[model samples]
Target: MSRSVSSHTSPVVRVDDLRVVFPTMDGDVHAVNGLSFEVPAGGALGIVGESGSGKSVTSLALMGLHRGSRARISGAIEVAGQNV
Candidate 1:
């Protein structure tokens, strides 16, 4: 099931059309694809998924943990009105 938060409140964090891909020897590993979300300033968000479902990769991407050479990330991530 998928649920989305209402855009009534100002968001502290916003992500749009996020995609993270890693090129490997055999093929590309798609960690995240077309993911988008928003977290209000005082609101909390939780992410749940099975193993290897790209949860960690999403977090890493949000925290800017992934090296540019190791992963290809294309999307918009905004925090406090600043694009990250």
Candidate 2:
């Protein structure tokens, strides 16, 4: 069953001013830059961009799959009102 989103309920996922930079021998590669959005309860998300436009990188950042790597992550990422 589908339910309407509650105005009073907090977002299920929130990403604010997120940035992901991968340091390389040559130079730094910006995977995701200044990306911010929120998906409320019972809400949905869609990311559309060209190839190499940080789509996959953003998803990885949300899941914290970039950890243990040389990637530098900043800003605030929250899921269910808890930091990710």
Candidate 3:
């Protein structure tokens, strides 16, 4: 299946300096650090990396799945001009 999108449009999602850290018994696990990117209104982004590269962590952060007390997330995430 295929879909069409407008040519002139702003970014639908924007993430800047995103950092997600989890405190473990050993130490703090830096899942994602200083990650930044933007997805245009009709643009697509693919994140590929080796195991334990924080791909799932980044996705969780974007979806606000991490608990505030369990993980430390510092950065800016904007979707549709609204900060989330």
> What's the lDDT for all of these models?
0.90, 0.94, 0.91
Q: Can you write out model 2's per-residue Cα lDDT over 1-84, one digit (the tens) per residue?
A: 868888888999999999999999999998888999999988999999999999999999999999999999999999999999
TM-score against truth, every candidate: 0.86, 0.92, 0.86
- Give the clash count for each candidate: 0, 0, 0
Worst 10 residues of 3 by lDDT: 2-11
TM-score of 3: 0.86
User: Per-residue alpha-carbon lDDT of model 1 for 1-84, expressed as tens digits?
Assistant: 856766676799999999999999999999999999989866799999999999999999898889756899999999898998
Compare the candidates by lDDT and give the number of the best one: 2
Candidate 1 vs candidate 2: the TM-score winner is: 2
Q: After superposition, how far is residue 45 of candidate 2 from its true place, in Å?
A: 0.4
User: Residue 46 of model 1: what lDDT?
Assistant: 96
Candidate 2 scores a C-alpha RMSD against the true structure in Å of 1.5
